[model samples]
Target: MRAALAALLLAMPAAAQTGDLVATDALRVCADPANLPFSNDRGEGFENRIATLLARALDRKLDYVFFPQVQGFVRNTLRAGRCDLVMGTVAGDELMQNTNPYYHTTYVIAYRRDRPVPERLDDPAMKSLRLGAIARTPPIDLLLRNGLIGNARFFPLAVDTRHESPGADLMQAVADGELDAALVWGPIAGYQAKVKGLPIALRALPTEAGVARMDFFITMGIRAQEPEWRRRINTAIRDHQGEIDAILRDYGVPLLDAEGRLQPP
Candidate 1:
């Protein structure tokens, strides 16, 4: 009886540890429910696809936490423990532990094909040229800091579409002569421009501001103390880079090479 009891006590901890690693308990992802080309409740977006791939690689199942992406996404979803991971995080966001980036998208200067591309927003010829850009995106911030606001014309937000996706319309608005040029998010802007066959050229600024490197990237994020989770995510990103690229490509997202030009394949 004593010998049997000792074996049972030894087995309990091992069993408990094993139980803790089940698929359903392993992955918990946070995403905005209505954000498209990124994530949503239906799991049809690129981020959702990538999350599924990551979960599959980790041999786990995903559980999602949906929330609005306003000011509270990080605090409400990440900090509140609604999920374990935050997809598509910007570099240096203070709240979470960000992993090494697996990919990058360029910040391009998009303009009508017939119009000469401005050498820089500060160029003299660009002074009277009207431009459209999202409110707080990197390029917009750069233009503001350089005092390029004279020619900058803010596009009025369509009250209903602002939350769902403001990029598509913003790009279309530029193509329709609603604005001369648009400083927009790379993927959405490029994808829409390509889809519309709008004879617009995407030019990499001679020197991009805000991010010091041309190879600016974004990464997956985990809770700050969860080093183990971070390691797992980073390993998955490194190991499954090819798969990641394929997913991005399927969405028409232009992934840039080290030179900041779009990769051929």
Candidate 2:
């Protein structure tokens, strides 16, 4: 019976093969309904705005397939034929073909304004401060390498998307004095720090030897079989680079150049 079931499942067409990119009137975007600075149901995240722009450029109405961006996000949404695009993803994801990079950002430090900020992982002051960062993140590895892990508080890398933003929680802890400082993703740290009215200073961490590169280029993700669709998305990204930069700036994303210097709007 198990072999028969397995054979039946094998006969089912793969999602991508079942649905080709068709000329549609609505641009279907897959997004996290609660993740801010990236996406949300209210269309307030930078990726939301970018999706809108992309839809408009393509002369299609904007629509979204809202889901929590957690484990199996790509498989359950994009690969399940529920949406046509993911507005923001790592540039070189192995699960899907990626468009040309739209923006680059890095990990950042979030600390209370009144407290001394440790600009680098190797700062001597960090040895004494109670640092916080998401567990399994690049920053945590850096902390461990520099012997700062002993004093660090680690949060879960994947939180329940239903009720938590780990980055925001870490920043709030900093503001409330429970933590001396926190290392968080640049976009989330900057947006949360400003929007939550926390008296915090956000600074992008510079790349250093022995630390994994903190910077990453972001791009749109499309099904690997949809080359024409990927090309269209890339064209839209290239045509609206200036507008996309503006949206990212509004969200306080720490845009950086290849040389690691901050980019101005």
Per-residue accuracy of model 2 over 134-223 as CA lDDT, tens digit each: 998888777878898899998887876669878778888998999998888888887876655678887777667877888899988888
Candidate 1 versus the native: TM-score?
Answer: 0.79
Which has the greatest TM-score? 2
Model 2 segments beyond 4 Å from truth?
1-23
**After superposition on all CA atoms, what RMSD does each candidate show versus the true structure?**
4.5, 7.8
TM agreement with the true structure for every prediction = 0.79, 0.88
Model 2 steric clash pairs: none
Candidate 2 minimal-lDDT segment of 10 residues: 14-23
Per residue, candidate 1 scores C-alpha lDDT tens digits across 1-265 of 9999999999876555423322345588988887666877899778999999999998887899888777767888877876888899877778877988977886667787887666677677676777877665566666766677766766544333326467766777777877778876666766665544676767664345454343358898777765556677889999999999988887766678887677753
Compute the lDDT of residue 161 as modeled in candidate 1.
31
